[model samples]
Target: MARYVVIGGGIVGLATAHRILLDRPDAEVTVLEKEPRLAAHQTGRNSGVIHAGVYYRPGSLKARLCAAGSRSMVEFCAENDIPVRVCGKLIVATEEDELPRLRALHERAVANGLPVRLVSPAEASEHEPALRCVEALHVASTGIVDFTQVSRALAGRAEQAGARIRLWARVTGIVTRGGEQVVRTTAGEVVADVLVNCAGLHADRVARLAGVTPSASIVPFRGEYYELRPERRDLVRGLIYPVPDPRFPFLGVHLTRMIDGGVHAGPNAVLALAREGYSWGRVDPRAVVELVGHPGLWRLARRHLRYGLTEVRRSLSRRRFARSLARLVPELTERDLLPAPAGVRAQAVTADGALVDDFLVVAGPRQVHVLNAPSPAATSSLEIARHVVSRLPTDRSPG
Candidate 1:
């Protein structure tokens, strides 16, 4: 039997291990997590919107996986009794200048085989009564669910399949000995015939530890949110998104109705001071120094200085953020927005200063490292896991 060691206990790692055990029942699968519990980082902190493959370029891994994964996710949720809502989404073009890009996005969605429709202002208002738009693309496959719950289910199913999960076990080093990979962690050392790194935030570092040079560096972008007051939740029927500015990497802030009936808004993207930094005050000197020293970050900043400044302004001023949201939902006010938890995105920046726009995976002998998986990652976890597992060399003898 093969021995598989997976680093990171996020949903992707759990799903990968689960798939491996299902495919090779006698294989020994072990998962190592740095946190005290699974989904403690990106998996738990995200906005929980199931992407409908609307924004990604056609034929990209993100586009393909998100489209297939969204369907699989709903099926999985239904089968496992996980709460899910296919509430749909409206990507509005508030200004005439944004209409061209919105049309382009609609074309991309069509090319990707999503059932999206371009709606007029009236149709858009019918879907979201409070929304104000010149034009919009209605994506029916978009929805919301509690990803933390999904992660828990995956963990439970993986454990049931005989996979061992070690929590609070931070991987310290990896050594190759006698044709087997030995992973040294805080809890103990684990030896495996194959190692898969699904380390989201520290994926690049983990790749380096495994003696592979990744093509990009992980730059954490903090997305801060505001929740609508309970009385104002009715303003958003499902999800309301702004047509993203093509110049920026992040999807602009929008309103989303959660599975639990709460509406969240305004996740303004800003450069985070730490990998797990949820707030501006939570800074890590090392992370700051590393980010500052990165030539790619500097180049990225130079190219998008004005937009970056705008994001920083929105991050600091509640009124600014509310104004941006108000462009989509005219009735919303600054007072209606309350502070919500923030999520840090593990964005990968290439050496030449371009943000990696698709899912990136790198492989070495007996090892696979998921280098970049940001937004839609949670939605695409299972499919991404299948892709990762398929990439592993199958010709190796069982250790």
Candidate 2:
């Protein structure tokens, strides 16, 4: 049996391990996670939106996997008896300038083969009664579920499938000995015929440790959010998003009625001080220094200085954040908003300053690394697992 070692215990890692066992039941599979529990970081902290393939470039991995993953995820949830709802979403264009982008996004959505339509303000209001928009793209496939629950279910099923998941096993070093990978971790040493890196925020560093030169460095961006006051939650029926700024990867501030019956809003993206930085107070000097030294970060800043500054300002001011949200729902105000937990996105920035807009997976000798998987990664986790596992050598012979 081939021994497989997977790094990180987020949904992707667990899903990958599960996929491997499904293909090779007799294979030895082990998952290493630095955290005491699974999904401690990005997997647990996201907005929990199962994205449709609306915003990504039509031919990109995101478009393909997300479009497929949406259906697969819902099916998995149903089979596992997990609570999931296809709540749908509205990408609203509140201003005249946003109309063109909205139209373009509609075209892209159609090209990507999604069941999306351009709706008039009246049509949008029928979906979200309080919404005020000139035009909107109604994506029916969009859904909501607590991903932490999904990760737990994945871990349980993988464990049941004979996969061993070791928590608190932080990888320290990696070396190849006798044609097999020897991974040194906090808990102990592990030997494997294949190594899979799904470390999410620290994926690039892990790739380097495994002797893979990643095309990009992970730059953390904190997405700050706020929840609607209980009474005000009625303003949002499902999900209401603004037409994204095409220049950046972030989808602008809007409102989402989570599966739990509360409403969330305003996840403005800003530079995070640490790889796991969720709030401004959680700063790490080393991470800041690394960001300062990265040429791509500087280039990215230069290109989006105004946009970055605006995000920072919004992060600092509740009133400004509320105003941004008000663009979609005119009835919303500062009093209707309450602070919510934030999530940090590990975005890949190239040395040339280009943001990797697609899911990036790199292959090395007996190793596979997911270097960039932000946003729809949770939505695309299952397909990503299938895609990655399919690339491994099919030979069942021992190393």
Candidate 3:
């Protein structure tokens, strides 16, 4: 029997398994992935920007890990000979009214121990000539890298460390038999001394299936993006972002320069009709009913009705979306933006209407469930993995 069974072969699970093997090379680890390959969902589809420790409250898990992981991930990439660039990110405040919020953001970054600088409008323009802003906070530590490449490398490391990755293996049930866990997967039954669930989109469902209930439900929010028309890709030199609205839990749409040297922009967070729905046509009635049934969803909508309405408006109206970008870069016209791929976030919300702000982990006698891992999880994979593995019961021998 394996020592550990890691469910969901995304970055977190693979990183956890790899880290376990790193500590105890003799431990047998098996990673069960529902998809054909790793990171095919959120991890693979993300914007590929290594987030700076900006936007999160100081001293939170998100703050601690994002900053530490930002450095660690960069080192891992360089050490592994993966292609990466330390092209910093710019959070531009386009309006006179937005400057105060930008300053608050800068103060948070400072509190979070990130090396950030306040750049004047003229100075901000020096780096991004076409961008217009009252001011911008330049995070020298923020950078861009391909998370998929990093994930593949981590998977390779895990394999080299003696961890077995089983693909297209959806875990249907997890039940403890006597002192061990019976992980019923598509491949076959595997009994192990320990289990870890790192399912991103279906994390809550996975936990429920595993007989652990958390307070929150996962709601899928679709983030839509548009690439700058090829003719005007020069509008963004690196990453450009607007000050996000505080009313909503989401960090509003922003422009990013991908590691592949392409500029992509806008990930407007809107309610998706289906859990995995990428386009407008793919709607699941059950998912819709379940999404609507969550009291948190209703409470969140009621509390942020105006903000919710605005996001829906932007989703339906390209002119409105373009206007949002125009606020930061006046040079970009509606015709200059073209449709791009969308990424749906697995946003967890409390029944009381609070968006789970930081990482949530629950530990059992024989298992651990990663309930909610917010943004930068991909960036903080190794550190988060270290944390997760350390929580496992060390006294138990392999089953």
Candidate 4:
């Protein structure tokens, strides 16, 4: 009988458990992970970029969490001997028409209290000789690291602090008996006074299992990447992003230098037909049908029809994808890159086809569940965990 049961071993869940122990060393917490190891989903399968709190709406959860979390994340990494580098990032205006959007981003960053600077083309070139941008903003706080290592360290620290973690415990249902929750898993069951649903890909489903009302559904979007051809790997010194279209939900495909040395390119967002579908070949009829039948998806289809169609075209044709890259780095050609592993996003959407723009959390009498935590989640894991712990009901039994 643990005091708290955290479903999902991703960074958020682990961080929540870690914080609970940090706050109350005597507190008993159990972390249930479906996979045999942690960080197997979005946590492990990301571009590894440490966001700099830019691009988030001012006064929003993203802005506050990312700014604080970025600093806490780095400090946590340093304290735990985890490897992370503030390699910085460049948000470039490759198209003349994109300058306005870039300027707007710079303004937004300022409003968000981010320490960003406008870089001249030459100055930008000094940082990235291969980068071709009319102008760019240098975000010094952005960095890169292996989130898997971070997650592992957090898990270790949590367990060290007297928390328990169960691997291969795929939570399938949550039964509420009296005032406690019995988390049903493949292994068996774990009862808890509070249940934190931090399940990433399966968050919505898990919440429903916990007898919570799901306001939105998780729509999987696969972000496909490409590695710079070995010879041209030097083209990107760090993260290089295109000016995002405010009308779009995602930052346009850009190049990001991985902690492992290679630069990954173009995580073009595409609707994944399956929950964990990573390839075009992978499909789940139910998932596909559910998505297609959704009014929000149809509305999204209408709103970004052109961009969606172009993404679909690029997704199927490497040549078109390479051309999209050429807008920023003119020297890049189709031959300069190779396919890389893809990551899927568990995007929560409303019935009206609008993307959830902020962090969404729902509360219970005895539990608090993180419903939707998007991009900055990895960057904001520690802070998110602290917040979750702060909200927990303290009077309970130790498992």
Candidate 4 colliding pairs: 1-399, 296-353
- Across 276-314, the per-residue lDDT of candidate 1 in tens digits comes to 999989999989998988999999999999999999999
Candidate 2 clash pair list: none
lDDT of 2 by residue, 182-215 (tens): 9999999999999999999999989889888899
Query: In order, what lDDT does every prediction score?
Result: 0.91, 0.92, 0.86, 0.88
lDDT of 4 by residue, 229-277 (tens): 8789888888899998887668988999888888899789999999889
> Per-residue error at 66 for model 1, in Å?
0.6
- Candidate 1 residue 129 Cα shift, in angstroms, is 0.8
Candidate ranking (lDDT, best to worst): 2, 1, 4, 3
Of the pair 2 and 4, which is ahead by TM-score? 2
The parts of candidate 4 lying over 4 Å away from their true place are 397-399
- Residue 177 in candidate 2 has what lDDT? 78
